[model samples]
Target: MATILSIIPYHFYPPVGGGALRCYNILKEMARDHTVYVVTSQPEDTFTSDEDYTLPERVVIISISKMLLHISGSSACKKVFNAISYRVKKRTLKGPANSFFLASYSAIISLLKDVKFDVIYYESLESVGELSGPIRRFSISFTHIYDAHNVDSILWAQQAKALQNERLMNYANNALQLEKKLFKCIDTFFCCSYEDREKLIRLNELKISGIVVPNGVDISKKPYDDDAFKYSRKNIIFCGSLNYQPNIEGLLWFYTAVLPALKSAIPGLVLTVVGQNASYDHYKALMEDESVNFVGTVPDVNPYYYSASVAIVPLLSGSGTRLKILEAMSLGNPLVTTTVGAEGIRYEDGKHLLIADKPQAFVEQILTLLTDKQKFDTIRQNAQKLVMEIYDWQVIGKSISTQIPVLLKEKYGGR
Candidate 1:
């Protein structure tokens, strides 16, 4: 088995998100067959504690300092000073830039100074530039594989179009340029959706070969319990990492457009919004409606999934596949989602999930699902079957593993 060194900004076990969970799950599975070493950033609290990381025997955790040298919204003078410091001392850039540069720098230096690994698996393009300096040193040869979780450029561009704020739009435009430049430097790229892959091919005008390793569901967790499945309330659920702009916008849109229509059609139609780091302003605004319940950051989301009559994804802007959709499908919840929200998932318009882009269509679908038990049950069963056959982590993990040997052969020249 090849010695694999994986670098991610975050991992599983604590302070979780979809990206972190996906990274952890893939690395955990990879560790079972190979000698795996993971280099990641840790929470400041964990740095001082002697808590054992929940990882495989072959996995290694390298913790880095989370010190912020300069706050993100600093003045122009502060920005210039920090940029000089970062350039000269190789210190990290502030905010979102910090995790990418600092973690990669620390990991590359640590690997060069101490540990030896056959391959370097970078989870995203955030730190691809860091590898350039190390690659120039001829003695240490390691293959690089990049997992582009999403087509970040497309995501930024979409955000730029949606945002009214000029400063945010300009930032998003700059981010898109950086992402495009970064994609050209990687050896291999993995994306979550074919749409994203196609976008890259069109944008770069290159026949860049990559695989669509879509996000998956860990069926073992079994998100919905028996009691939740039997809940009588006609509930509609939207679950996601609320801090994400797309998710926040989706939830806000649902409340503003669809919720009133659904309430008017079916009296006492409950809408439960479940997620972490949900904005207090958003929560308070929704709470004023009386029908909306904002459940912030539950330990387990399965119960909420089960309790819902139908899961809704009203995403307006996002680049990749929705893991939440996969999770809801795995849990056997009948779903109503926008065409954009349901992108990349293999599902029929009315079979596995009800697809509706407009607010009126969304409300109509929800009303139909609420009233028609047979249709709801049929879609639920079909979604669950699809999850079992195709979208499960076990199946996805094997496909991801298959690529490793091919990558190894291309890099090392031997089986």
Candidate 2:
């Protein structure tokens, strides 16, 4: 077994969305045979939660070193120190010189002082953040594997364009430049989808080899009651992180364009927004809607997934394939997602899941599932069959377990 350091900006467990889930599952897979040491952080006080998350049995965990809080004076003095040191954090592009990220970088450097890892696995762009330039030297001895959860450059650029802010546009440019430098330091570039791989190669003009490690579902969890839809109510479920801009954008669109019409057509139609707690201020409309239920951050999403007559993803932003689509389909929700949501994943539009872009089209599909049991069951079964074929984490993780060891041996002479 090899010793590996899994580095990321956020805590992967109790994952609220695809990025965190990707980090957790991949590191869990690596820990099956490798001695994986995870270095991750919880978000600041505002977004922090008490939700319990159990890590895989064999992995070791390290919270980000709060060296910033180690000032030798009074509490007020420490505040003054942080204000003096990182007063510019809000002005800099996100992930560049953030306190936690800087501290995590410090922890990694401290680890490297005494620990020579066989592989240094960075989980996402947020994981690499602005530390790529400094970490470049360590790449000489360590097998640097970058698991890009998404092409964040494109996402940031889209955000920039949508907001039409000059400052955001500058930030987007910085993200592109950062990615360019980051790719140069990596040994293997792992893309969640072929689309992302194509975008990364074309946009960054990377010479490094890119591998597709598609997002997967844990099909091992007793096969979520495929027949649950038969008893479920007139419920529509949207399960994802509300804090993510894309999901928030999608929900806003759904509420504005589709939900009103859907409710009129199908009486008692309920939309339950699951996953992280959505702020009333951020999601004012979604919060106040009479037909919506906000079930924030459950220990297990299977109940919400199973109780819904249909699952929906109306994503208008973000890059990479959506794990929500795969997860809902795996649990047999008979999903209705936009083309953007289904990007780079293999599935038939009508047979495996419903693909809708416009308000009318989305309503039609939801109605089809809500009213017609046979159609719902057919799509449900087809989705489960598809998930079993390719999206199972057991299969995906095992592939990593087998291939990564070979790569390590070839590159650095295995332990």
Candidate 3:
């Protein structure tokens, strides 16, 4: 058995988003035969209750609070850092800023004074940047694993180009420079896809050890009836957190470009939106339209996925694999996503799901899903088959459990 430590920036129990979902599932699996410690965000921010979530036997939740910066450094310095976090949250809506996130090497190190962990899984940019200074101080040796949720530099550069902001470009440059330093401290990087792994290697111009661990759905969590799709309504479903900038950007783009034509053609067509809401003020017309219904933050998303005729992912820009795609596919909902939306996942267009980039093409794809019963059934079966064979969390988790120990043994000579 091994001792593993995971420090993610958000609350992961009963995970709401992709990152949180990945963290929760991975740690649960890791705790099977190992001692797994999680230091994640306070539940007051990401989630409120643990009524439904059952803890794994060997999994331990170490700490849950805001230690964003080096809280143990100095009183005045901590206040300054907290103030900067406040300003950033207030000024911009982009990025994950629900509250002061959970991240601090000093705080974590202090708690784990004498104990030595065999593996260190660092999950956010805040956590990654702090490891270089702290890991050197500890005499114990361990394999530091960096969980690359997305390529930070690329995502930041995309934001800069999209918004035409020089400040964002500077931030992107700083991110890349920080990664160059981070490369030295981290022994292995767990990327969501081989595509992301390739991009990271090309950017740093270094041959680094990395593994592809894709986002997955917990297939056996609840029983899903795939036959429900045959009797479901012709309505479309689009699910994602509105707090995220990319989801908002994608939805608004679709609403402005394709909704009118789709609504005109289907007459009674409705787009049901699910997930947490934070940014929808700019798109008032969407809320006012009778053809669109926004169902924000449901206790259960499986019913929504089961009831809809087809699920649509209209993302214009983002990185990493999307959990929504896997979730929809796992529950027998055929998908239509843009090329940007379909990144990272090894999805074959027209087989697992339909892909379209242009506005008219996207609309046509949705129309086809609604009209063509044979094509929809074929895609649905293929997608569900793909999920059962590859994207199910149980299967992926077992693979992760097997790989981590082997990597640690290979590096440290069977400690």
Candidate 4:
């Protein structure tokens, strides 16, 4: 078995977002056959002494609390200032505000001592700088694997364009430069989509290509319940963290442009927005509307998935494969989504799910799916089957683990 060290930038257990879920699932999968060590960060206040998460006994989790420039559980004003200051200092410092994060690396390195890891799996490009220095100093020979949740540069640039924020724009530009400079250090790149892999290849002009490891759902953890499917289901579910800009942007667009038309077609239809940290302050009208119900954060999202007739993904801009789609599909719900929403996943329009970019098309697709039972059933079945065959965490985890030996062979001529 291989000894793997994974470095993540967030408190990964009890995954609260898509990125966290992906990291946790990947670690869980790797722990099945490998001695996996997780080095992650958390705010000092929220750091827990008790290990509450469900994981294999073989997996060792280590947290670096209150690391450099890392803040959590802070007030809104504090958060805003911290964000701005971090960005400003990042530019002034000519590098990431990762000094404290890098310092935590020493603790991790000291803990490992003489033990040599066969591979290093670093999550997100943001951690590359903090990890690179320590890994180089600690080990002479080890394969480096970069798991790209999204093309950071591209995603940042898109967000900057959307928000028109100068700091974000500068940050985006800086990320682009950093990615180019660090391209040579990565031995293997695990991207969530072909689009991202292609972008990396074109940007860096690298001879080696990335492996597409799409976002997946843990079906075993939350298995599909056939009884949850209702013949008279009038609920249209939209699941995503409300605090995320991309999700909020998509929700605003759907609420204004598409929801009215869809409501006109099916008067009884009620849209249920489910997920954590969804602020209804800007969406006061939606909150008051009887047809729209905002279920702000739930411990179990499976019930929402199980009860809905169709799930809508109205994403305008984001990168990487969406776990929302996989979750909805795995629960046997038909989906109507925008082109941006369906990116990276091997989804066929009108087959696995309906894709619509414009307001009229999006509304029409939802209406058609709700009216046509045969089409809805076929699409839902296709989606569930597709996920079962391809996007299951076990399948994805195995695919990732199997690559270690091959990458090892190429690097050292033996596993």
Candidate 5:
């Protein structure tokens, strides 16, 4: 088995998000066969000490302090600035302002100075430029696989437009430039979706070796009880990290356009929004209407999934495959999402999922699903079948594993 070093800004365990979840699942699978070392940032929770954050057996976890690296900023700004500075300096600005950058840079240094590995799996090239100098220094023989979890720069640009944030727009523009420069340094790249891969190819004009390994759900873990599946309740659930722009935007759209229509069609139609890092103002605004409920940061999301009659994804702008969609599908819930929201997943309109673009269309789709139990059941079964056969973590993990040997062979000559 090849030794693999993965550098992600965040780790799998604490303070879960989609990227963290994906990273955790993939690393766990990879660890089954390979010696995996992960360097990620540690969350600042008073309850959880350093000793509490443990890695899996045979898996190494390096936790970097965010305070030392100066990784403080609004989420969008943080990613863009990190991407740009990393591209130019190859070392992050030192201090509390950019700790994530410092953490990542330090981790790469530690890997080069302390450990030996066969392949370097770098997730999200947006901030990877920070390692360019160090990467060049150690660039002689190791295989480098750049994993683009999302077309981050594109998402930044889209968010900037929606929020009318000029600083973010400028950052997004600069990040795109940095992304192009960074792409050429990697030996191979992997994207989470076909749309992301295509955007990387078209925008960067780089024909680098890459594959689409879509995000997946852990199907082996038995789902929550069918009794928890409250088909009798007229409840619609939208789940995601509430702090994320795309999710926030999607929820706002649902609250503004779709919720009213659904309530009109089926009175007392309860809407549940569940996620972490939700601000008081955000929750307040959402809960202004008595029908909407904000359930902040649940330990287990299964109950939320089970309680829903339908799962809604009303994303206006974003890139990459959505884990929320996969999770909803894997749970056998009927989904009503916009075309953009369901961009990367292999689903056909009116088949495995119901895709609607306009607000009115979304409302109609939700109403249709709510009213017709037969059609809802059919879509739910189809979604579950699709996820089982195609989007299971085991299948997707193995696809990623198949590439590891090829990368190793290319670097070590069939070692």
Candidate 6:
């Protein structure tokens, strides 16, 4: 078994978003056949506490801050200086930059001493810079595998378009440049979708094809149920990390444009918004609306999935496949999403889910789905079948685990 070093920016203790879910599953798979060592960050609250996580026995987790606190404060000061220096040096260049020089990474630098790893897995381009200190400290030949969560440049650019912000556009451009530079050191690229893979190839003009490892659902978590298609009070469900800029923007757009029209048509229409970190005050008017119910973060979203008549993803801009869609579909929840919402997933528009871009078009589709029994049932079944066949976490994880050994052999002559 290979001794792999995986670096991630956040803790996967309570896997929440797409990125976290992917990281958690990949590590879980890797630990099955490898001695996986993880370098990750925790909330400042966990800085002094010994917290037990849901990790396999083969996995060894080391907090970047946990190691840093053992070192003098001067090391952190130097890290800050380095970050500022690097920013100033790159000021002439226009592109997105990774958050590598964070003080936590500086702390991580002190912890790589005398450790050995056959391969290094970079969770995202953002964590690419953490390798510099480790590489400089230990001169070893190890394979570098980059797991591209999203074409972050395109994602940022989409956000720019959605919000119409020039500053975000500039940040997106810079992010593209930084990612391009980072890819130069990557031996293999594990992309989330073919769309993202093609973007990488076009942007970098690469000779080799990327490995597609799409985000997926843990099917074993809950049993599949077909009751998600039941036509009740036309209760609409929207689930995601509400604090995320794209989700926030999409939710606001739906609240303003689509909900009003739907409510007018069906007097008893109900919209259930479920997820965490939502700044409720930002949408005070929407919150006060009698029909709209915000069920802030819950332990299990399965109950909501089973309760709602239809699930909606009115996303205007984002990158990567929607985990919410996969989770909803796994429960046989009928979906109504925009083209951007269904970007990475391979789904037939009318069969798996309904796709409508315009406000009026989206409202029309929602109304039709609520009123039409046959169409909704067909979509619910098709979506469930698709996810069961293609997006199961067990399958996706095993695929990555099997391929990594081959990649290691190809890159460094052995696994």
Top TM-score hit: 4
RMSD, every candidate, angstroms:
4.0, 4.6, 5.4, 4.8, 5.1, 4.2
TM-scores, each model vs. reference: 0.86, 0.85, 0.87, 0.89, 0.86, 0.86
lDDT of 4 at 141: 83
Q: Which wins on TM-score, candidate 2 or candidate 4?
A: 4
RMSD of 5: 5.1
lDDT of candidate 2 at residue 232, scale 0 to 100: 46
lDDT string, candidate 6, 1-415, tens digits: 7888788777666576667878888888889888898777654454332232266788777766554443323576765655564455344233232343343454444545556677778886766643533453454577777888888888889878877999989878877886666555666678877888888877767754588988888877745665543865468899999878889899999999898999998988899999988786656776788898888788789888778888999998877788999998888678999999998898999999999999999999888888888888888889888988899987887887788789878877784
Q: Tens-digit lDDT track for model 3 on 1-415?
A: 8898887766677776777788878877778768887776644344444765656878766544645333434577765665565445335434432232324444566656766788888887657665533554564587888888888888888878877899989878978886666667677788898888888777656756778999888777533446734524758999888767688778988998988888887878889988886555755777777788877789888888776788999999989999999888887888999988989888899999999898899889988888888888889889888888898877888888888889888887887
Task: Summing lDDT over every window of 10 consecutive residues in candidate 1, give the lowest-scoring window.
Answer: 44-53
Candidate 1 stretches greater than 4 Å from native: 43-53, 66-107, 136-140, 182-184, 223-232
What local lDDT does model 1 show for residue 254?
Answer: 89
lDDT (C-alpha, whole model) for all candidates: 0.73, 0.76, 0.77, 0.80, 0.76, 0.77
lDDT of 5 at 104: 68
Give the per-residue Cα lDDT of candidate 6 at 213. Answer: 89
Candidate 3 vs 5: which has more lDDT: 3
Candidate 2, superposed: residue stretches over 4 Å from native: 42-53, 71-102, 126-129, 136-139, 165-167, 228-232, 409-415
Write one digit per residue (lDDT tens) for candidate 2, span 1-415.
7788887766556665777777777777777777888776653332334345445666766776355355333577765655555434333432323566546656777787777778788876655654544565544677788888788777888877776778878877877886776657677778888988887777666666678888988886526565644634788899898877788888989999999999899788899999785777778877777789988788788888777778999998888878888888788788899999899789898899999999999999988888888888888889989889888877788888887888888776775
Q: What is the lDDT of residue 273 in candidate 6?
A: 90
Against the true structure, candidate 1 reaches a TM-score of: 0.86
Candidate 4, superposed: residue stretches over 4 Å from native: 43-53, 66-99, 225-231
